[model samples]
Target: MKKQIYIVGLILFGLLSCVQKHTKDKIESNQSRIFHYNNEPYLIKGICYHPVPKGSDQRSFETIDQDLELMVEAGINTIRVYEPIDDIDVLDKINSAGLKVIIGFGYNQNGNYDILSGSFIDYVKKYIDHPSILMWELGNEYNYHPEWFNDDITNWYKALNESAALIQEIDKKHKVTTAHGELPDALALKMTDRIDVWGLNIYRWDNPSELFEQWEKVSEKPMYLSEAGGDSYMTITKQGYEEGFNEKAQADANAKILESIFNNREVCSGVTMFSFTDGWWKAGDTDTQDIGGWAPNSSGVPYDGTPNEEFWGIVDIDRNKKETYVVIKNKYKQTLTEY
Candidate 1:
C-alpha cells in the first residue's frame, strides 16, 4: 500500500512538471507586425474570441486553452477581447499558448459605455507590461451611440485622447487603438492623434479595396481589420454542399475580404476575423441584439439566422469547423508566410 501511494505521488509530480513546462514552452516572445518587435512585419491573423461552454455561460479555462490551441494551429497569432478578463492566469495561459492579446478598455464587458462609469487607466495599468499584450483598444463602436460624440465630438475625442495618453504613459511599448462601426467625422479623426492603430469593424460585403481607399484619404496611420465577418448563409442547400446553411457564402465573403487585405498590403496591417465561436448568449430569448447581461439562452439552439448575431463565428460553439474555418485557415497560412 505504501508503494502504491508513492507511485501515485510520483504521477502527480510528473503531471505538475508537464503542466509547467507546457505553459513555459507556449509563452513565446513575438513582436507585432505593425509595432515591429524587431522590424519584422507581423501580419495579424486574429480572432474576436469569447467562448463559454456550450451549456453554460460561464467561461471554462480548459475550453479556453482548447480553443486557443486550435487557433494557434489555425495560424491565428492574436486574440482580441472587448475588455479585460477577471482571471489573470487565463491571460498568462494565452501568452503561454504562443498567442498575443489586444485588450479593449471599454465600459461594461461589451461595447456600450459612459466614460466616467469605468476606470480605463486602471485597466491599462493592469496588463501594460505583460508580454502577450499587443495593443490597448479604446471603445468598441462609439459611432453607434450618438451620445458618445453627438454634435460636439468633444466627448469622444476627450475620452480617447485622455485614455490613450494614460496608456502610453504607463506602457510606451504597446500601441493604442479605437474601433468605429464605420468612419468617424473629421473632428473626431483630428482628435485621434494619440491613437496608434485605426480599427474598423465593418460588415459591408462590397469591395474591400474601396474601403481601404476611403480610409487612406483620412488616416495614414497603420490599420487592421479588427472585426469583419458576415452572418450565416442559411439557405437549406447550395451547389454540392448541403449543410442546410450556406456556410460557403460565409467562406467566400471571408476569403474575399482577406484577399482584399492582402492586395492592399501596403496600407493594411492585419485581419482579426470577427469571431472564433458563435456565442448563443447574444440571441437572448428572441432573435434580437443582446442588450441584457451576458448569459446563455435557456434553449440550446444551433444558429439558423433567426438571430444573426449567434452565427458570426468561424467555428460553432462545439469548436467544430464552419466552412469559414477552412477558408480562414488557408488565407492566414498563406498571407502571413508567403507575403
Candidate 2:
C-alpha cells in the first residue's frame, strides 16, 4: 500500500511540473511572437560580440563585414555592445549584417547623475526608432564595484531607474534591462517599476536551478545570462600564462551551460556567451595569452588575476572556430520551439 502511494505521489509531482512548464512556455512563446524586432519573439541565441581588432571605438567596414561573416557561420542572430553609437552608417552595417543589437548605456559615465541622465535621454532620442535595435541595456556591470563607490547605492539605483523610465516614456518600442555582475547584485538592488528584463553576467559554477528559482521568487521579470562560459589557464605557479587547460574544457563548460539553459527555458529568456573572438589586446600590448581575468576565486587554483579572460572567445583572434564554437553553432541553429 505504501509503495503504491509513493508511486502515485511521484506521478502527481511530475504532472504538476509539466503543467507548470507548459504554462510558462505558453506565456514566453506568446511574447516571443509579437512586438519584437521584425515581428518575431525574444531572441534565444546570441553572442557578446565586439569584432573590433581592439577595445577601441575604431570602425571599419571591412572588419565589420568579416566579423559578421563568422557570426553568420556560428548561426547567432543577436549581438550585444557596450558603447553608445552615433554613426548612422555603422548602425546600418550592423542592420545589413542580418543581426540585431542590445545597445548598452553604461552607468560608469563619469559617475555624474545629471550628465549621465541627460546623455542617456539623448541616446534614446537618436536610436529609439532604429530598426536594428532589440533592447536598451541601461547599466553594464555597475553593481559589482561597490568599493569604488563612496556614496549610497540608492543614488545609483535612482539614476539607473530614471534612465530606464525615460526610455520607456519616450520610446515604448524597445525593452530595457540592467546588466549586473552576479545574481546577488541583481537581487540586492530594487528595480521593480522601470526595468522590463533582467540581465545577469552570471559565472556561477553550480546550482543553476536554485539560482533561477531564487530569481523567480524575487522577480517575475524575464532574464538571461548576459555573459558566461570561460576557461582558466593556470600556469605551473598559477601566476603567469602557460596554458592550464585546453580549449576542450572551455567548450565542454559552455556546452553544459547551454544545456542547462535549454532545460530551464522558463527562467532563461536568452543567453549571450562572453565573446566571439579572443581579445588578444585585453591584457596589454606585451601580453597576449594572459587575458583570463574574469575569474575571481583563485585560492586553491594556479595564478590569480584573470586566467579565464583572454581565452573566453569561441574563436581565436583570427576568427577560427574552436570546439565550443562548433557546439554553440549547432545549438544556435535551433529555434525556440526546437530548443
User: Compared with the true structure, what per-residue lDDT tens digits does model 1 show for residues 133-210?
Assistant: 888888777766656455545776787787787777777777888876665668877877898888877665524677
| Worst 10-residue lDDT window, candidate 2 | 297-306
Residue 92 of model 2 has an lDDT of: 86
The pairs that clash in candidate 1 are 26-96, 27-96, 33-42, 233-246
Error of 1 at 166 (Å): 1.2
How accurate locally, in lDDT, is each candidate? 0.69, 0.67
Error of 1 at 276 (Å): 0.3
Best by lDDT: 1
RMSD for each of the candidates: 14.1, 7.2
